[model samples]
Target: MKTVLLLVTLGGLLVLSLVGGLFVWWGMGGVDISLHGMIALTLGCLLSLLLGGGLMFLVFYSSRKGHDDEHHRGPEI
Candidate 1:
């Protein structure tokens, strides 16, 4: 069940990304912007993933670093 859910979630994201790409392609056709559209779309998706992943990493890293710092503090006399 968990695997099925994961697959469905990933599939939904792929479909949405493709739909976004199509919108960009059609919306900017007047200026021969297909290449630009694709680049922009790819960058946008990459940025989104990077930002989201970075935030998650930052949270966990800060928490774990603080944890280790406290653990390493000298024992009270």
Candidate 2:
């Protein structure tokens, strides 16, 4: 029951956010982008995703390989 309630609440919040975003977008005139602008947006989004994923991958890799543990130790003389 708790899990179901939590999911429903979260889903409602997501829908509300989307509706609010669309309303703001509509108020902003909703202008169409040129092909070049669209391509730039797509590439920018892809590169951002790639960079974020690569950094997260490094985080996990370093953690598993114990590199993260080194930070917890006092500096050696």
Candidate 3:
């Protein structure tokens, strides 16, 4: 179950990175705004990083909780 969950999470992260890169590429083709392409790309990259980190942290926290619960269960004769 843990293996399956990890694989799925990694797959999702790969897709997210690709989509974010595409957005940054798309944003490159427009007329210059007040802040220009740099700002747009910077913010997009930052958002992606934050999102990916948050997802990874959630998975780790859940796994830790599951293990802790199992550990607290006393041995049965």
Candidate 4:
């Protein structure tokens, strides 16, 4: 059941992104944007996703390793 739900959610997002991309391309018809600017934007977006995913992976990894478990630290001196 969980797997099915995840697949459905992912499929919806895939469809939404495809539609959004088409809309953006259609809206920006014939706009002369610099090649360098487009390359920079694409690289920046890719780097941001990499960093965000790495951070999330570290968080989940730590949690699985019990790093998130609470420990009682007795009265502060």
Ranking by lDDT: 2, 4, 1, 3
Off by over 4 Å in 2: 1-23, 75-77
Model 2 C-alpha lDDT per residue in residues 1-77, reported as the tens digit of each score: 99999999999999999999879868889598899998998899899999999999999999999998989999889
Please state every model's RMSD to the true fold in angstroms: 5.3, 3.7, 7.7, 3.0
Estimate, for each residue in 1-77, the C-alpha lDDT of model 4 and write its tens digit.
99999999999999999999989988997977699989998999999999999999999998888867644345669
User: Each model's TM-score, in the order given?
Assistant: 0.46, 0.61, 0.42, 0.70
Model 1 gets an lDDT of 0.88
- Clash count for each candidate, listed in order shown: 0, 0, 0, 0
The lDDT for every candidate, in the order shown, is: 0.88, 0.94, 0.88, 0.90
The TM-score-based order of candidates, best leading, equals 4, 2, 1, 3
Clashes of 1: 0
Off by over 4 Å in 3: 1-34, 67-77
User: What does the lDDT read for residue 23 in candidate 2?
Assistant: 96
